[model samples]
Target: MPLADAGLTAWSWNPLTDIQVMWSYPFMVNAFRAGAVIAVLSAAVGWFVVLRRQTFAAHTLAVVGFPGASGAVLVGVASGYGYFAFCLAAAVVIAMLPGAGQGHGEESALIGTVQAFLLACGFLFVALYKGFLGGVDALLFGSFLGIGDGQVVLLAVVAVVVLAVLAAVGRPLLFASVDPSVAAARALPVRALSVVFLVLLGAATAEASQITGSLLVFALLVMPPATAQLLSPRAAVSLPLGMLIGLAVTWLGLTAAYYSPYPVGFFVTTFAFAAYVLARAARTAATAFGARGPRPGTGATGGTPHAVEEAAA
Candidate 1:
């Protein structure tokens, strides 16, 4: 199931022909399906991640997946179990740790300490699994090759469950994210929602890692959502925009990687980063050009018309 063979060769001349060829292969089909799952799930979950300021947690869960997979391999178990188990465990630990009501410096230090420790554990497991454990880089930066039908099915099931749970709590989750004090005052179960969100984040991180690699899941999970948020003023438009950007990046990256001799994760990450940069630059330019700044407020306060000020004199 070496997907490289299914890719465009020197003989591929026409763009349409190359696409058809890429789509004709079964492995390519699975790759597309898996990539799509990652794209949508990651982006959707990433919107919340951005809102909650939980990128550090997201990255930690992603890195935790590597050790999970490696340890599973060492124990002759499925990697998915290891990934899910470790990520959920990490999320619970993080949720229990002191983040709020503590100094930002102390919280960040604690988070960083957990990250460092996890990375060390991942490397240790990789080192221990000396029997055909595959490349360390490959484990960190995943590949679509050899992905089976069962995995595809499992991925779909996991995604549906995550999205369903998200939908159930969407509004209250939004409230909690924006203003936890108000949400808690309203008796909206804010703490439970925070814990649930962390679990969802872990699930999304693990799932996204299957396609984008453990290290590179941030591309799908952060860049597109961040870009969308920067560009769109309204959450209504921004949330779906992030998913669209993610899907575009995944599709284009997969196609480009098919014709070129590079890993799909590399191309996907590059495309995501490029999109984010372009969005940020465009936002900056618009702000610069659109700034008409500080019209004399009608009464020296904000948002009033600039004219008719002489009456006061």
Candidate 2:
């Protein structure tokens, strides 16, 4: 698989031909499949992560996967097991910290402490590895060259299970996110929901790291959802819109990386950041235009002012 040879010297004018050439390799096929699965899972869980204001916790979980992968390599096992095990364990540990009911300042402090510790452990594991570790660049940034059938299947199965669990708890979770005090007054299990969501977020973060690497997983996890929220406030629209944005960026990144000599993470992050900037500009323009429009009950028809309209009402 001359994926290293830059099989595609130049993109043709024909879109179909370009796509056909790109998809000819089995590795490319697996890369696309794995990227799609990770994007969907990350975007879905990321919406909640943003809504619950748990981006700090999400960042901690993402970093936790690095040490997990490194430790797995040290112990002579598949990295996927280490990714899930360490991330889930870290999530549970974060949830069980003593600052549950206290302010976010304390919880965030504890989460940051854990993140720092795990990162140091990752460096230690890397130092302990006696082998050449040729794939260290891929571990930190990203590479789409080595995705396989088994990895694709594993990603798909994990995405299905995580999304299903999210769907099961969607409403109560939303209620709790919006107003935890009110939800608790109604007998909802706020704490339990928080723990479950963190675990799921951990799982999603770990899986996403397989393609984007632990450092750049936020390209999928945060950017798309943040851009979607800027476009629309409604969850029904923004949630799936975020997924679509993530999937688009992933496919675009894979395609770009295949033709260029750069890492996939760079392309993915660049594309997502571009989309967010565009969305922000559009929102700003709309706000400015709306402010300049005619006020309520005072249009070109010589309508009464808002005060007059209210008086008549």
**Model 1 misplacement above 4 A:** 1-8, 11-13, 100-104, 107-110, 131-134, 293-313
Q: 1-313, model 2: which lDDT tens digit per residue? A: 1454655446676889878988888889999999999999999999998888777677778788888988887888767778889888888987887544223664667656766888889778877887636666666677787678988898899999999999999999999999999999999999999989989998998888887888888889988998887766668877898999999999999988887778898999999999888777665655455445543223321121222223322
Question: Where does candidate 1 clash, by residue pair?
Answer: 142-213
Residue 10, candidate 1: Cα error in Å is 3.7
CA shift at 306, candidate 2, in angstroms?
A: 30
Query: Which residue ranges in model 2 land beyond 4 Å of their true spot?
Result: 1-9, 98-113, 292-313
Model 1 lowest lDDT segment of ten? 304-313
TM-score of each: 0.86, 0.87
Model 2: worst 10 consecutive residues (lDDT sum)? 300-309
How would you encode candidate 1's per-residue C-alpha lDDT over 1-313 as one tens digit per residue? Answer: 2445754254367888777878787878888998888789999999999888888778878888888877877788767777888887877877776563122574677667766787787788878888555656667876767567787888888989999999999989999999999999999998889989998888899888877778998899999899887766567777888999999999888887777668878988999999898776665655454445432222222111111112111
After aligning candidate 1 to the native by TM-score, how far in Å is the CA of 46 from where it should be?
0.2
